[model samples]
Target: MKILVVDDDPNILELVSIQLNQAGYTVQKATNGFQAMELLEEELPDLAIVDVMMPGMDGYTLTRKIRAYADIPVLLLTAKGELEDKEKGFLAGSDDYVVKPFEPKELLYRINAILRRYDKAVDVFIQAGPLKINRQSYEVSVGKKVLLLPLKEFELLSVLASKVNTVFTRDMLIERIWGYDYEGDEQTLNVHIKRVRGKLENLTGEVTIATVRGVGYKLEVASI
Candidate 1:
């Protein structure tokens, strides 16, 4: 597997490359997000490990930009270990996140987990009653028509729809969707949820993405 590792720090770039190479994967290095973008244009890597802090473009912007075209799995690296940072990464588009000073084995394990998750079947179109979610296609439809959605909206809905009625704490949502280093933007999650709810209002009357008061949100499956 060809893995692209993006980090501004030379030590991290060298160390991560060495570790991935030792693990028997081909490694590519990018010192910043722009360099990573250039590499991406030339080679579509199997996986990407990106740092949150960079010179030209930050990890979140890079993730968002790349996610526009490809859904190739992404693992984020950040020194800022906060729920908000984790949420930001998820909102920007990331598969997983890890903190700085992390164990190489742990990072390897997270990569394995991400790859395994991809191996499992996740139907893009999850239809139940009036709602349908296209996980791979990133489209959502209700009743007879399909609605356009932004990347964050689609990703947030995808996470919620995967398991109905399961309440996700803000932190879990951040970790599962945004990645670990994600910064605060519950408001980001809130806005997208509100937008998704508005789109589904005709079918369900109210929001299918349920807010748990002070906690987080859940996907309320409508019974037919």
Candidate 2:
């Protein structure tokens, strides 16, 4: 998971970045809310940690702006520990609040808790026959066995599994999996489909990928 850390203090930014990095998370740093918003526009992070005392674009304002469009969770990290400050942070759409001088373990714990809540709220799993695809972890499982595929292959299977027995056109798949800016041709989609098919075959025969001649592909389940 990626986390954005925004603080005017260089020391706090470095400290928070180190803590998040050591906890197996990718960290993006920003000295102020403007820089953070720029980074957000480039690529949204899973969560954001913002300090409330920045010169311009305070934490509360940034949290409100982020909440207006993105669903990314925000955690206010600041020196203000008063009750009113906590209430204001919550009102600004922050998922949690952490005061300064906090223990590293506590910060990590809160981050994990917020992420867990978000995952449970939005993560969707696709189940086709005996196969289960976990969107969050990108793990495909059948029975008690686990199968991992390359990113593209897994995404292909995921798209097909989303609507079993429904054929998706080659162009649709390409546009959905590879963005519209993709410069590749139909050959790329075919290659990914072939790889996904090979991997699915190793699992139970309950699910299969079917190619619709002159069109695209679909996921077929024996029970359906």
Best by lDDT: 2
Provide TM-scores for the models: 0.54, 0.60
Candidate 1 residue runs with Cα over 4 Å from true position: 122-224
lDDT of 2 by residue, 13-91 (tens): 9999998776656899999999999999999998999999999899999999888869999999989899999999999
Q: Give the range of the ten consecutive residues with the poorest summed lDDT in model 2.
A: 115-124
Task: Quote the positional error of residue 185 for candidate 1 in Å.
Answer: 44
Model 1 per-residue lDDT at 100: 91
Model 2 per-residue lDDT at 69: 62
User: Which regions of candidate 2 are displaced past 4 Å?
Assistant: 126-131, 134-224
- Model 2 pairs in collision: none
Residue-wise lDDT of candidate 1 within 27-62, one digit each (tens)? 889998888989999989878999999977999999
Residue 106 alpha-carbon offset, candidate 2, angstroms: 0.6
